[model samples]
Each structure stands twice: as structure tokens, then as C-alpha cells.
Target: MPHIIYNINASPTSDAGVYPIILSGANGANYRFEYEAANLIINKAPLSGIINNCNRIYGEYNPSFSMSFTGLKNNELSPIWTKQPRFITYADKYSSVGVYPVSVSDYDAKNYTIDTIEDGTRTITPRKLVLKVNDSDRLYYQDNPTFTYTSTGFVNGDDISVLNKTPEFSTDATIYSNVGMYAVEIFGAEARNYDISYIPGNLIVNKRVLKVVADNKTRRYMTDNPVLTYTIAGFINNETENILLKRPIAQTNATILSDCGEYIIKILGAEAENYDFEYITGLLTITKIDQVIQWKQTFENIHIGDQIELLATADSGLPIEYIISGNVEEYKSGDRTYIDCLGCGEVSIRATQEGSVNYNPAMRVVKYFTISEDASIDNINSDDYSLNIYTKDGYVVNGSLSQQYIEVYDVSGNCKYHGTDKKIHVGKGIVIVRVNGRSYKLVCK
Candidate 1:
């Protein structure tokens, strides 16, 4: 962990000083802080800084220090003197916790069973059962075993049905006489005979079984979910398992009607999953023999809503995720097909584009106006005025502005203002103005 030292030098903001310096890694034990000045002795000795002068000195007050704030034995050391205009040290504690490795064991309860074996009427010796932990991480931990002849009807190699299955053994049909002192062996060292209780969630650990061995060298960790894992049959490339998508017959590439002719409809690599190759007829064939082929029934000319079967070889089993489209000679429509979306819970048929698209480009209209000079707040006596609005299509709409004030200004230091209350026609383009008393025209947009 890095020990960051925020050294607040006694000098003001004008002087050059290093404020915060981070000291980290294994070499941080030998890190030292130094304060030096030009044309003076550089302090290289490692010692904690001590305030000697009031604030400044004539020569140089260079002091180097090792981090030893914990051993502040001076009772007179003021807390305020150590804080203000002084360097401080702090080490992050969160990065110091040590991490250790742990392992877990798993078991299959269905595989093994338990049985009993007896000798005489008065049993001289009880056939004892025991469990062992062979991990070497525990020093002096021996391979201790326990008897499984307990009250829970436990037998040797019996599935651990209950906690009383420990020391689960019986002699001459007699149940456990003393239960507290006895220890029973519930699970064994076999990979499929033990269960580890460390994992959380629905414990379905299926990749590997729990084992008790002298060496815990295998890289198996405690997992939450467990499932039955098996291999797929007859697969060559490491038995590659994939998700296949089966859907209705659809087009992959759009049918482009560039010119009118007998065009053979070819199936793209993606569209072959929708149709069965062997069952389809009057369409292109996709087989191991020939991957792609022309349509059997050739269209004299391409048209919309034309059906074509796409066959894919079994080698390429899964269908590619895409829709097929084509352009017809009759209409130059976009790359979209109308279909019913059932998942929306409503009958929705719409044309959707396949790839990237650009929307329609449009132009914006900016009106520029010209104002007359004589029109102002001091001059307008009549209420009649004319307004003209025009469009890019060469259409003009006109209106009159009456009984309202018309104010205008130009870049050449000219002003025209008026009041008129009439219908005004505002249009998109260069605008012209007319005033009753003004003679000069002012361009004001």
C-alpha cells in the first residue's frame, strides 16, 4: 500500500514546493522526505521534521524525515503545530488485508449405500467406521476416522441422510447405547461421496465431484449452481454444441430487379435455415454437393411478394439471424417487408428497413427584410401596410399589416419605425419594406 504524504511547506503560494507525494510498494519502507534550498546544504539524513524557527530563517531550514508519526513521545508536541503549515503522513488501510485460498467438497447421494456385519452374540469388538480429512494445510492434523454406528440408522457407506448418521453403525440389532461421546463417519474421500457446504444459491455443482486427497492441487472451487453435464454424440470439432434457430421461410438478400430478364433466384447463406433443403422444390438447392444454386423456376421478370425456398446444408445447421429482401422492377421501394408481429399482442403489419439508412434532406427558410427610413414612432399616422411571403416552390402569399407599428433598422446607420394594424404576410426569402413618409430603403433582417 502507498503511504501518501501531503507536505504543506511553510512557504506561501509564490514559492516552489512539492505538496503531495505518494510512497508505495515494497520499497516504501525506505522512503524519505527532504527540504532543500538553492546554494545551501541539501538535507539527506532521514529524521522527523522539527520546527526550530518561528516561520522563516536567513540561511536554509532543510530537514529530511522518515515516517515515524506513531512514536510521538514528546508530551509538549502541540497538535496545532503538527497540522498547519506542516507535512502530514497517512497510509490507506483498506489495501492491507491479506487474501487466502479456500476449497470446497461435493457429493452424490444416489451412488453409495450402507450395510452391517456382525460376529458373535456378545460382541467383543465393534466394527468401527471413521471419516478423514487429508488436507496438509493443517499442521499435525492426522487422518482421524470415526465410527458410523449411531441412532440415525447409519451404516458403512450409507448416504448421509441426517446429522445423526455420524458414527452410524449397529451390532447384533442393538441401537446406539451412548450417543453423546460417539463420532460417526457420514461421507468419504471419493470424489462423488462428499458434500461441501460453503457455496451459496441453489447448489447445483456438476462440473466435478468433491474429493478428500493428500494433495489439494486441482483448481476446483466451490460453486453455487449444479447440473448434470454430459457430452453431445457424433460431433467432430470438440463436439461443438450450438443453438439452432428454426423459422419460417424468408429471403436473406433482397431480390434486386436491375433489368427485366429471366433472373434465377439464389438463396443466400443465411436464409437456408428457414426451409428444408430436401423437401423444397422449384427453388434454389443448398446441399453439401453445391452450397448455392439458381432457382429451378425462373421468373421472367422480378416482382414483389415472390416466394422462393432457401435450402441450407446440414453442415451449416444453425440459421443466420437476418431477414432477406429484394428490389422489384415495377417499384423502387426501400429494403423493408411487411410482416405480422405476434409478440406485440396486436395485429401490426409494417415495412421495416434492413440496414443503415439516411432520412430525407430538407432546407430551412430564413426571411430577410428591408425597412424604409421615414417610418418611426414619431411619424406613422396611417394604419395600412403590405407584407409578402414566398416559398421555394415559387408560390407567394400576401397580407397587409394595418394599425400596427413597423420598426426597421439597417447596417448603414438608418432606422425606420411605424405603427400599423393590418394583415402582415411573413415569407421565407429576402424581404422589402415600404413606408408612407420614408424615401430610403433599409435592409433589416
Candidate 2:
């Protein structure tokens, strides 16, 4: 059987296993066979072009082979997720912001860059994206950036019409303040109060400040002191008192003399406080005595001895009361007769006594003797005199006169004694005796 029983193991197609062989007839070249390649021989299959080129499943080319597939897939599918639209950059650049999303149009795609974002089409940097609330761009890395709102009349939800501008009360406003606000009170359409919180920040400064001032006025100037005099207007008695005396005349109720020199009047000037001025209209004094007494004898045409009672009364001057005894002697001058004083206190003679028609003794001077009875003369005082005697112009009674005589008589008309006076003392009553055979009856005390 010449090995009609075929040894299939030896045949090149009998074993489906990996084999190494040499092609002897082809110049001894080396060849290798994979199990799948030997199976393709056992199945009598033709070689595919993939296997015909090279099969590098488990060699250094395997990793490099899968990488090519990945590069091709990336190049083809990249446009699906990576394409962008046009967007705006910040017209003015900002410093510290980074990239962020922004709105855009698809037509603006050429404006995009790598490190920016886009809403749907256009790309934008975060520094260029302006926030609606503040109109400030976003900083790339800033957590929160500074901003300002440009809306009119909008604040932090407070009812303040005036904003960052200065507040004015009226046209002519008055602001009452010290250096700064410790407290404040205001009244307008409403009453408002504030604490130190009225100041917001330290952004502004006051270079110059204001100040205040005051004014005043007054009145007082029209009265002080003057001078005056005093006098009396009326007096109690007119004839004997002085009135209208000078100021400070006397104390109240004091005695004073009137102008007419009559009766006394009381004073009324010293008790006044101010100056007492005077206007005296007329005489306010008692110038006359109230009453008079009359005595007359030897004035009849028939009766030898006539007598009438006379009462003592006050008159202008002094008058005496006495009993008319006898006349010592009598003389006629003009139409009047004068009799010397006899032993009585007085003697009376008239113009019609013993057939006398006219007698005027106004120019006659008489000398007579004086007499005395039992009366002592020293008992009379100075106030009791009937006449105030003064010597006639250039004639005076000095020392004593000699040749004087005296007579003594009784009440019955009988002569008691007559003698030349020797040492007839003064202040003694004496009786009269005349010389030349014309003795007169006179007495003096």
C-alpha cells in the first residue's frame, strides 16, 4: 500500500496547527503560519487583502493601529460640539476679570476666541459682559466687583427724593448746627428727627464753614434835679405880723412876723420836703389895733368940773388911766390949750376949753415940773412906760440938771411940803413946783 494509507500529519494540509517550515525548493527561505492561516488552507480558502498586506495583532504595531482610528473619528465629529458664534469684546478693557458666557448671534462666529464663551453663536470675554443691574463688566477672577447704577430716582428702597446731591430747605434756608450733628430736630411738612447716622460716608469734605452774630437796642434819658424858693401867702393877723417871708423861714407852728407888723402869725415853711416857691399877692398882716380908750376933761363951755368914765382898751400906742385932780398951769397955742400934768396921772386940754376957738399944739415944745405923793417910783418896769423919749435933734439930757424943785401933796389938794431938791434920787416919784411966779401942778412916778 505504498502508504496508500496516507499519513495526513505529514501532508501540509493534514494538521490545522501553527507550523514553521522552510521552502526548500525556493532557496531555503523561512516562513511562518498562523493557526487561522492554516485553517484557511484546510478549508481551501483564499487570502483576504487585509491578511495579505500584514497582520500585526500582537506586535508593536497594535497600539499604533488603534490610535489612527481614534484620530480619524475626532477629525470627522469635532464640528458637532466645538463650533461657536460671534460675540462682543469689552470696548474698553478691564483688568481683573476672566471668561464667562455671553449673548451672541450666529452670524458673528468669526469674532470668537479660544478662552471666551458664547450663548449660542458669538463668543465673549467675561470682562466685556456688562451686568444689567450695575452696567459694569465682570472681572475674570473677581468674586464681586465695584459698580454704579445709572437709573434715575432709584435708591436702596428708601423714600428720599434728593439723592447724592445736597438737600435744600428753601430759598432763604437757615441751618442750625454746631461743629457736627449731636442731635437734630426739623419741622417741615413733617417733623423729622435724626441721630449721628445722617452722615452716609467719608467721600466728601467741607473746606470752609459758616458763623452767626447778634444785635441789640434800648432807651432812658430825661429827668433829674432843680432849684426853688419859699414864702407865706397869708397870716393870722394882718396889721402886726409879717407875711411872705423867705424860704426856710421857721419850723411848722413857729411864730413869725407879718408884712404889716400887727399881730403874730405862725410859720409854715420848714416842714416841706421840696423847694417851696412863693407868690405873695398882698399884705397878710394885722396893721391896726382892735380897740382904743378915750379920756377927756376941761373941754366944756359951762361946767367947771366934768367927768366921764373911760375904759382901758388897746390902741395904736400906750394910753394911761388916772383920776384928773387939778391943773398946774395952762398955755394957749393956736386953737389948742395945753395943761401940765398935775398930781393925777394925766392932763387933758381941748380947743374949746374956756372960750378957745382954734388951738394947734403940733409945733409947740413944753417943759413942766413933776410931782409926787406917797407913791414909790421903782415899782414900774420898762414895759410900763407911756412914752419913748429921745432928745430933740442935737440936744441931749446928760449928767444931771440942778435947780430942780419938787412938791408933795395929798389927795385933798393940800400942799404937804415944797423944797429945793437935794439928792432927789432917780426912779422916785416927785411933785412939780415952777419958778417966775408961775408954778405948775405936775407929778411923775
Candidate 3:
């Protein structure tokens, strides 16, 4: 072995005194050594005390409350307090009403265990004040009014005058001159004994009583221009004493014309400073200068010798006069008119009404119809006069048929058959046939 080495360390100690250290080394053989260390000193552990006395804090008035502690020596440790219920760091000033605990601890932290002192609870209280105003009296236009109120914790002798504060209404008569609701408030009044809180009050101003009377009138169509008139009473000021109220401005959407209907005449923006005005609404009735009417009818698939009656209807639910002209003759009985289809042509019937007191001249509407025979055959002479017909059941041929073109139509003018064969099949109906410019009608039974 080259050389022997030894290392040593001592455990941490709280007490100060002399102590011994032993060392051992080995180099092929065991050896031991001893030494004494001196002058080791350990300071005393920090001590903490309990706080027993605490001052009551007025959260509103005071900034902080002082505390007293016991069992602490020489100011060796500083007091660090905690607020209880919540157990947070203590604050100097208190703002809310509650009981809080404060704990004291040493400023110097030691490795050894230490004790802390918890103090008794500190109490905080709140102070509040409120003010209110009384405004139960009703006010009228052009009248001056006074106001009063009740209070809590605020005395009348505290040099407090409501007029010195910001008031919603003063003694001026103009404050109550309008017909509306008003709030009278007195705020920011300072008092010596207690805090002042403000609550607003209401004042209602009434206007002079008034009424509007309107007259009912009628207008004739395109003939008369009706003027809207009204009467006003209870005028309170010289501005309207001898003044005549003009007709109200008409609304943009209002229609007054000869269309024979009820119309509304509204008085817009009618007001007087000292007088309470009422909205005026009026009605005007209009009558037509002449009777007006309309008629509707559909003419389809009319046959010759068809006797048709024409009846005209009007929106006014009045009788309509009928006039017939064309290929048809009209027969009148009572209020009804009949038309006899004379031939295969077009005929027109018109509806009309003479002028009446409640209506303008009647507007006329005409209806037309075309008449035709059901089916008729015209004889044709052909060398190949061979004719063949086919019913829905089967085919039938008369004589020897030739290769001639054939076309057939229904009574409603719809083509039913077309071909070049002698025998053609068809459904059961009244059909018109044309072969090589000759025409015939077949009633398929």
C-alpha cells in the first residue's frame, strides 16, 4: 500500500460544547488517531408569544387596530399575524364587519421547532345612513310646488338643507308646466352626525282638460271635396283663445277617393302649450258615380241547336242587363236571358248595367261560343268505293276496299285514327272520318 488516508464529518448540533473526533487508517496494517475540537457555540432557538389583547376596529372610520403580545423576549422575534375565519395575511385596515384571528410568530426562522401565539378575535362594525324624499302631491300646469322627505340617522339640526344639494326640481313654475312624469332628486348633502343616502321621488304634472268633437260626412264620387272639421273646447291660453284649429295633416298612406269605401281622417300633431289636446279621428263615406260590373263564362264544345241561358253576376249583388248579338237570338224572361244557337258559327253575349245612384256606368263583358253538328256524312262517288270499318271488338269491311288514305276525329276535334289500311280499329265513340276529300261520321256502337 502506498499511503493511508481518512476523512470525517460531524452531525449538526443545537447545543454548543466541546466534542471529540476519531480517525482510522489502513495500509496493510490497521492504525488509529484521536483529536479534540473546542470552542463550538450554538445560539438559543427563537421564542414566540401569544397576542391576548386586540383593539376593536371601526371598519369605516379607522385604518388599523393595534395588538399586544406576551411571552416574547427582547424583540428577538417579530410578530407576523394571520386573519382567521379565512386565515390569510393580516391587513392593517378592515372594511367589513366580521371576527378575525391574528397569530404572532418569530421574525427569525430557526432549524429547531418554534411556537406561535394566536390572539383573540378582533371585531369590526359597519355604519350606514339613508335619505328619502316625499313627493305624493300632484302638480298641475303652471303651478309651483314644494317637496319634503324622511330620513334615518340624519338629524334636521345638522346644518343640512335639501336646497343646497342638486335637486331635480326647483321652485320655478316651468318645472311643472309640462304634462308628464318627473323625478325630483336631492343628492350630495353632507351631514355631521351620520352619512346621507339619497333616494329619488316622482312628480306628475297634469294638463288642462280638453275634448275634440268631429262630424260625420259623405262624399259623392268624383264630385265633392269633403272638408274635415272639428270643434275644440277648454282652451286655456291666449295663443288658442280665439284661434281656430286647422285640419289635421293627413298621413301619407291614407287614401280618400271615389272608390266607394269608408275613409279615416286622422288629426296629426295637434297640441297647445297650456291646453291638454285630444287626438281627433273622423270617418268619411264615399259613393260611386256610376254602377260597375264584371262577368265570367267559359264556352266549350257547343253543338248546334243548343239552347243556352246567360246570367251575369255583379260584385254589388245587383241585377245585370244582358244584350245578345251575333249568330244567336236572345229570349228574355224575367231577369234571365236565353240564346238559341242558330247555326255552326260564333255568337257573342254581353252583360251591361245602366248607371245608378250608388254605382258608376256598368262595365260590359262579352262571351263567345262556336257551334257544330255532332256528325254528318257527305256522299262521295269513287270507282274504288270500297269502305271498311273496325270497331274495338274487331274489323269489318264493306265491299272490296282500295289503298286510300283515311283520317278520323272525335267530336271534340281530337284525331282518333289515321291509316291507309282497309280495316282500321277504333274505340267506341262518335268519330268523324274523311277519305280522299269525302267526309262521314261513324257512331261506333
Candidate 4:
């Protein structure tokens, strides 16, 4: 073997690098054999280490860590790691204060054996929390309302459910407390992952509200005034209208002699402790009494030359005046307010009483009386030539119908007219007039 020569003089080193190798024979002085070449490769030596444990406060990000190398072989230098191992944990910043497993992922360890990869631990500590309370108000003698608060510093979607016990609020104020400010306090809250703190608030006690009202009353003319009264509204705590330091006084400017109108009944001078009073006025109605005339007389069936006394009275104790009409005469003599009816034929008298300042006007009274039926138609002789019989009562008809022969009779069954004439004279009282087949009773004015 011609110079089974080799380039194997030196041994490989523990360092990592590439060295070239050539094995070939010198060309036997003339022709050289094809050279054989090869390369020697040295890789990095393996290393070992243990992952370090980490700690983090609750509601914070996970902290970074380092590794502890066990040793190196052949006194080799530690290799430069391109990628380091990673630690994984199920615990988050929001996790409760405790120890949690921190396992390591090799990442090939860059040829490093990560001993006790699962031996890592992450210790989480408590987070800071602030509970700030809200202010409130209440009226005097009122029950306290429920209090509330707001919190800061929660992490990883954690809320009040993360707390073992919620904070409770309280106050020294009571239903019997005076109208002034009171202290509101907070206490009793617990959570494993938090160190809680507080911001205090207050509650204000205010005065209560109430109203005083006057009662309305009414009175008639020439009558006594009614008693003025008052009522109270919005009383609390078993309080009544009698609890006022100065009770309301109700008054009005109305009297018996007042005209028919509305007057204000005012409520004034009301006082109470811890209560704001509002006064409300009422109405006082002064009205007039009704006055009426009393006359009862059905004067009927009397002969001529009859003399009758017209008598009537008034409810107002006032004298009644009488007016006579038709074929009657009236005479009022001296201070006596009496009407004398002396005449024949049909007569009517009206009695009236004018109203005074204390009384309303009386409705007039009237009565009709027939002394006798004068059958003599002296007034109709001049009007009989007219086509229509226009009597004192009214016009009878628009036009006459077929077989329209008219007859007139007096109340005493005396035939005044039996001729076929639609025109006739009706004097007074009630009379029957036959037109066609119908009979109508008419009264002359």
C-alpha cells in the first residue's frame, strides 16, 4: 500500500468546530491516485440544569426566571443558548394566594437536560383593594336605607364573587335621630387574594315636610256664620294635628250680611318641630236665602157685583203688593197693604214681593176669578165683519175648513152665537167656541 498515508496525526478536541481530513497516496512519483477527502464534525457538549421557582403578587403579571446549571462535561464552556426553556403554570395573577405548580417545557433544552422540570413553583401573594362607600340622605323620623360601595383593583375577570364576604355598611342614625349629619361606617369584608382598604362616607338627616289646610264652610243670608276649622296632612310617626306647637288658625272675612259671593278662608300661624309647614287656603261661600209668596185662591162661580178681598203673604216677612186687571178695581188705603177686588166679569190679581239685601226676589203669585159671564157682545159687533175671529186669547186658525160654522157659548151655558160665522168676540174667562166639528176653549185677555 503506497503510502497508505493518512492525516490522522491529531485527535479531535472537545470544542465544537469543523476540521478537514484527506487520505490519498502520493502519485507514485508519476501518477497520483484520486485523493480521498472527508470532514470531521464536533458538536456542542450537552449540559444540565434545574428551572428556578418564581413569585408574583396577585393581580400581576408572571415574573421571568433563570436556570441553575448542574455541571459541564470535559471542562467544556457553557454553550450559548439560542432559546431558553419556558415555565408553564395554571395559576394567573387573579389566583388566590398559594403555591402553584410551575412545569418547564424543554425547547430541546439546546442539548441541555433540564432536571426536575416539574419541580418549579410559583408563589402568588395578595393584591391591594379599595372599598369606597357612597353618601346618602334621610328625612327625620324616616327609616335608614340600604348602603352600597364600589371597589377597585380586580384582575383576570375577577369580581365580587372572588371575595369570601362582602362589606356591610352601617350608621348610628336611627328613626329617632335629630335632624343633623350622622356618620356612616363600613366593616366586615374578607377575601383570600386581596388586602382590602376603605374610604368612609356620611349620611345627612333632613327635616320632614307637612301641610296645613283650612276647611270650607257656607252660610245663608240673615244667618249665623259657621265655625272655621282646619286639617293637617303628611303627618308621620303617629303624629296628629294636635302635636303642633302652634296649631293653625282658620279665618275668613265673611259675615251674615255679606253678599252672595266666594271668600277666602285663610290658614295661618302653624308651627311644629322638625317639620316644614305649607299653608293651603279654603273657600267660604256666602249665599242668599230663598223668599217666596204664598197665595191660595181658586175664585170661580160668582155673580156680578161681587166684592172680594185679595189676600197673600210673603216668606220674607215683607208686605206683598197686588195688581188688579180685567173688569176689577183695586184700592190701597193708608199703611195697610191690602188689595180690594170690586168689579164684575173675569178678574185676576198678581201678588209680588221684591227682594231685599238679605233675601232673593219672590216668585209672583196670580189668581183668576170670574164674577159673572156678560153675554152681551157689544165689542164684537164692530169686528164680526172680519173673516177671522181674533179674540183676546190669540188667533184661532190660519183658515176655515169645509162646514166651518162657528158657535160661541159662555161659561154659564148661555149661547152667545149660533150663526154660521167664523168671526166672534170673546170677552174674558173661559168660553167654548165650535169651529167645524171641533170645540176649543178660549180665554180672553
Candidate 5:
């Protein structure tokens, strides 16, 4: 048999298992022996203890806090002794007026766990003071003005002293005398318990002064009457007393005899109290009267037995008078007048109106006619009387007649030529000839 010896070293992390001790024979056969070791058990360390759980402090100033922890031993499972507690906060200092929650935590580096967590709160508040004052005030010039104010958040029986030196008016004396807007201030007050706030207000002072304003106008001569109007400021209207200024005097009167041109009417001697005088120059003009004349109608192409009254008009508003001459007779029926055509001849009519104060005399001439049977009569073809008329180049007629008077008329019944000669010259058109009570139609073309 062979003898064997074995030595084993074990640590805390050593594994628990069986070991073998072997002895070998020189020929072939071998023997083995085994030994077992017990398993090692380690206990966990205790958790750290929290000394301070919660706290509170003022936020207006910087706050200081300390977190103390116990039950931590110098071992592998214990908390880190060199590490300090960390604080989770939104800002470094709480200057604003509000409440804040702070968290305090301790970390263990060896055990990888949180030891303790603490919570705390901080609050900041403003000093209480309430101020009240009037927003605005109005007063007349040379009148006394005053103001008052009130406050809150003060201790009982404690008087509140305002820092405002002058509460009535502005520092400048001219501000009250002038008519304008101004600002008045109500200063803040500093007290032991609370601070009073500052406020601003407005002051309005009015002055009594008059201002006159007028508008310039234009007028027509002998047609429009001139009227003066004005606007006065800073004055009141009353029925019991007259507050208006006197009517202004005219230096030059408006007259119809002025020439047709632009003229000035100077205004003077206007007075009022507490007001300044102002006047605007006015204009007057004279113009000539317009003359209008019209002829309503003229009677033309009139035949025999045709009656008509000549019509005419004038702006002077007067009745028209007529005078008839030539181969017509004037006759009146009722209030109307007319001219009567008796024979185949032209008649001259004249319409006239007398001059008036505003219009000149007007006249018009009307020439009318009467038709004869010779206008439609065909050319006479007799041995005793032969008439032939042509109007191609010019009016020409070759005729033989034993008559003392001869007359030729166009197709429109207008007499073209009248004489006692056998040959006649007239314009180019169809014509009729009357000779010795005979009628003949002559085509002068």
C-alpha cells in the first residue's frame, strides 16, 4: 500500500465540495479516498436609521439643513461614510413668495441601496399693506382742491403715515391757473409691520376764457340778404340774461348800385366779455340781368283761307302784340288774335313785346302765304296762250300771254318770280304761272 497526504486552503468565497486523495501501486491497482467540507453562510447588515424626518424654514432667506444617519458600520454591506446627503431643490434660495418641497436622500455605495429619505418645506411671503386713493378730481381755477386716502394691514391703534407731502395740487403754481390736464401723485408709506404701495392720480383744472370763431360767406347782390353768425366758446346760454355779443356793425353796406365785381363788407364794433374778438371778411357781388327771348312758332306753307296766329315769348312776362301786312287781314276773336289769308299772296306778320324793368324789347317776323289754283294747273296748250318752263340748267320760261300781271311759284307754293314780262328766270324746279286769270303748270327741269 502507498501512503498519501493532502492540505486544503479555504476562504469565504471558497466552494463547498468533496476532495479526493489517491495512492497508486507500482504494478497497476490504485486506491481513492474522499473528504467533504461544510458550506459557509454570511448575514446581511442592518439598514441605516434616519435622524431628521421633516423640517420647515423661511424661504425669503437661504436655508441650511443637515441630515444625520446612524446604524451604519464599517463593513462591505454598510453605507458610505464619506458621502454626504444630497438635497433636491428647484432653486438655491427661495426669494419669491411661495411654498417649496425639498427632498434629502443618502446613498450607500457599498450596498448599492438608499439609506434614508427626508422631506421638508419652505415658505416665503410678502409684508401685508393695502393702499387706496381717488383716481381723479376736477376743480375750477382759483378754487381749493383736496384729496384723501385709506389703507389696510396695519396693527391696531397704529397710525399710518403717508409719504406724500402735497395732496392738493401740483408743485407748479401755473398748473392750477392753466386750462390743461395734470398728474398728482400719492406716495407710498413705510411702516413697521407692512409697506404701503404707491399710487398715481389725475388732476384737471379749468379756466374761464372766451374764444370767437366765424365763417366767411358769399352773397348775391339784390338777391340774398347778408346774415352774420358766429360761434362763441366758454360761454353759457341763459334765457334770463343775454350772454351773446352785440351784432357787428358793417363799415360798408351792401348795395345794388355796386358794379358787377367782388366787393368787401367790413365788419366792426363787436364786443363780448372774457372773449377775444375775431371777424372774417365777407364778399358781395353784383351781376347783370339775363335777357331771354323766344319765338314759339312761325306759320309757313299757308294756303288761301288758312288762318294762324304768330306766337312769340319774352322773359319780361308780357303779352305779345302782332301787326299784319300784305295780303292778310287781322281779326280778333275773344281774347285771341289771328291773321286771315284772303288771296294767293305772301303776308308779313310781326310779333313784338314792350320793354320791362328787367328785360329788353323783343320782336320776331313771320311770313306766311296763300296758295292759288295756278300751283296745280297743267301747262296751257292754246294758240292764244303758250307757256313752257324748264329748270335743268337754270329756271327759264318761254311763254306768250296777253296778261298785264304774271306770277310763277315753285311746287311748295312759294312765289319764285312775279312780273309782266313774257319770259321769266327762276330757280330749277316745277313751277306754276298765273296770268290773266289763267293757270298753267310748268315743269322747269
Candidate 6:
């Protein structure tokens, strides 16, 4: 058996190669017993490593970096590091959010070259930003106001001026829009340092005030009422009456047959979405009509007994009342008037009409006629005028004629008609009529 005296041990920091064993004394009888053939062999170690990705907020600094190694020979296999690896990234607190390359500086694994199967890297990520739009309002048919917004989470105390691209605000409303609700949208905002979130807002519209007034008018009695009208005020944004949902209505109680008086004209029933309405009233006046009486002053050609008509009319279409001045026979109620002159004397008639609510009173009017005895009433045998004769239209009677007196009697001296009348009405029988002292016989048939 060949016996060895000194030994050789493998260390983690030892170089991998063939080495000679240490010998202070040799036990070989033969001085050169295989001294060149006894040697220890070491193999090269396989190694691998990786650098991790990283992230952070926009306002924060970069965190520390690390690397993980794989495929070491064993737990007992440890490599001595001559120099450690150094890592660096382009991302910083104020840097834009994007993929940035991570690089390496100096790295070593003892005397052996380290085969880095995976490359090391440092990653940068975007921070959060809050953006919001402000609410706004305006009246109907008015121009739009300026829009604005508020922003938060800007890094380094930066404002909207630091943003490379900014969003815009818009709404569904316009200057000519009516009263309603509309949406406001925020869109298309961009910045290098942060991710954005938009908060929506609202646009409001209010109603406007409007005034309406009724018009005044006038008319006469028995006339038609005028057409009602009104006036409007306070319109905006080049608006017209055509924009109204329902037009205003004017009203009154007067008609063509209404009496003479004052009436109230009112305004109401107006409608519109964007308006507040106020109403006003007006007045209508009616006046009385003038009136006159058409009549004559005097009549002609009078006799002892006669029947005549009193003709009189009023322009107001009212009835005429006949007033007699002396003793005369008259009929009161009818469209026509008749009077009887019983005796020879002067007679007079007056006509008048009282006023009503829609007409003025007519003026008073009068007319007269004279009565006389006839000269042909006497016989031609003597030319003397005597007290025993009474004259009528064609002849003379036996008695004198009084202005209001006439009489008729029966043959037995019974008086039938004792009133003032141009004609006598009696029962059927043999009857005697007496005019003054003269007598006439009538037969019943």
C-alpha cells in the first residue's frame, strides 16, 4: 500500500484548477514514486443573477435597488466578491411617467467572469392627480359665462402651467337654449408626471320676469264693443313673441247689447317656460245718446164737430204721451192718436217723452186749432143774426155751442149721450137726438 503523509483541502475562495499536494517528508522508498502522477482537480463554477424592476409615486424619490442570484454550485459553494455591482435609473421625483432604462456600472465575482443570465433594471411609475370642473349658471336666452376648474396633486408645488397638455371643459347648453339642465364634460387632459381623474359639474338656467298690460277703450250706447288688445315688455336674446308657448289673452264683459256703463278689461292666460308673468287691468266707457222730438206748432180749419189725429214722433224711438190743454176727446194707448172737437172753440195738444238710462229726454212740443160758427147756417128769408141759431159745418142749429158740451136724448126726454163726442152710440130703438134745442129722429134697423 502506498501511504501519503501531508494533505490538501478545498476552500470556497480557492482557484479552480489542478494542484500539487504538500509534502514536508516522503515515505516513498523509491524517491521518485509517482510524484508527478498524484494531483487534485477542481471544476469551474456556473453562476447567474438578475436585477428587479421597481416603482414609486410622482412626488417621491427613487427607492433602493437589489439583485437576486441563481444557479450557484451548492450551499457550500460561496464566491468571494472582488467588487459589488452598482445600479442606476433615469427616473426621479420630477421625471415624467414612462418606461426608463436601468443600467449597471462596475460588477465582479472574484477572478471569474459573472454570466448575468437576466439584466438588472430600475422602473419608474406615474403618480395620481385630481382634476375637477366648477359649476356655473345663467339666465335663459343669455350668453354663456366663462368656465373654470381646480387641480390637486401637482408635484413640486407646480400648477396648471407645468402641464405639457391640459384638458378642456364643455357643456350641452347654448346662448339660445331654454330653461333646463345640461351636462358639463372634461376630456383630453395629459401630463408627464401624473395620471388624471375628472369630476363632472353642472350648468343651471333661471326664469326671467315679464310684464303684460291691457288696453283701454270707449263706445256709445247701442254700439259694439271694441277688440281687446295688450302690450308686452322685457324680452331678451333677440327673442320674439313666437317663442311663447301660449300667447296672452284679453277679456271683458261688454257686448253689442250691453247697457251704458263702465266695464273692466283684464289680462290673463299667458304661458311660457322661461318667464314670470304680471297682469294689469283696463277700463271701458259707454255714454248716453242724444234725443229730439219732431212735432208742429199749430193746425188749421176748425168747425162745430170734427175728428182729427195728433201726429208726433221721437228720434230716440220712444213712445209719445199726448197732453191736452183744453176740453177735447182723446184716445190714450195706441200707435196712432185721435181727438174729437165737440164744440166750437180753440183746442191744443202737447207731446213729450221721458228719458231712459241710454237716452236723453226729448223737448216739449205743442199745437193748436180754432173753431167757429158757420155764416151759411141762416135761412135767406131774413138777414138778421139771431140768438136762436147755432152754426155747425154746413148749417145752423137751434142752441148755442159750448167748448166742452154735447147731448143726445130719446123722444120720452131721456138723455143718452151727455159727454163731449163727435158721434153718439146708442141701443137699437126709435130714438131722438137733440143738439141744443134742435131734434133729429133715428130709426132702428
Scored by Cα lDDT, where does model 5 land? 0.50
Expressed as tens digits, the lDDT of each residue in 64-152 for candidate 6 is 77666665554534455678677767777777666666666687765345676365545556677888878888888887777778887
Estimate every model's Cα lDDT from 0 to 1.
0.23, 0.26, 0.53, 0.68, 0.50, 0.67
Off by over 4 Å in 1: 1-401, 411-418, 421-445
Local error of candidate 5 at residue 317 (angstroms): 10
Model 5, span 1-445: residue lDDT tens: 5454444444443333343333333232563544444433333344544433333332234457545445444433335444666776664333334556667665444332444454665444445665655544443345536655566554434445522332322323232344455666565355433445655555555545444444344544345545645454454332111643564565445465443456665655665442334555555554445444577575657654345665566665566677666655566666667654445655666677665543456655454444442333234455544444333444444455443466665545566678866557765544656554444555554
Residue 332's C-alpha lDDT in candidate 5? 66
Best by lDDT: 4
Instruction: Indicate whether candidate 1 or candidate 3 has the larger lDDT.
Output: 3
**What is candidate 2's lDDT per residue for 284-310, written digit by digit as tens?**
222221333333232322111112223
Cα lDDT tens digits, model 1, 1-445, are 5544343333331222234333322235676554343232222112232322211111122232211122122231322132223232221111111221211122111111112111111111111223432211111111223222222222333444533323222121112121112222234222122232211111111111111111111111121112212222322223122411331222222122122122223222221111112211122222111112111222222211222222211221222122322221112114322221101111111122221111111121121112222311212223333432222232122233434244332212223233452333332222223333222121222
lDDT of 2 at 424: 31
Kindly indicate the candidate among 2 and 6 with the higher lDDT: 6
Off-target runs (Cα >4 Å) in candidate 2 are 1-286, 289-291, 296-317, 320-445
Q: RMSDs, each prediction?
A: 46.4, 34.5, 21.6, 12.1, 18.0, 14.3
Show the lowest summed lDDT stretch of 10 residues, model 2.
210-219
The parts of candidate 4 lying over 4 Å away from their true place are 1-63, 66-79, 88-90, 99-121, 130-139, 148-161, 178-183, 199-211, 220-227, 238-257, 261-282, 289-445
lDDT of 6: 0.67
Model 6 sits at a Cα RMSD from the real structure of: 14.3
lDDT of 1: 0.23
lDDT, candidate 2, at 71 = 19
How do these models rank on TM-score, best leading? 4, 6, 3, 5, 2, 1
Q: Could you give me the TM-score of model 1 versus the true structure?
A: 0.12
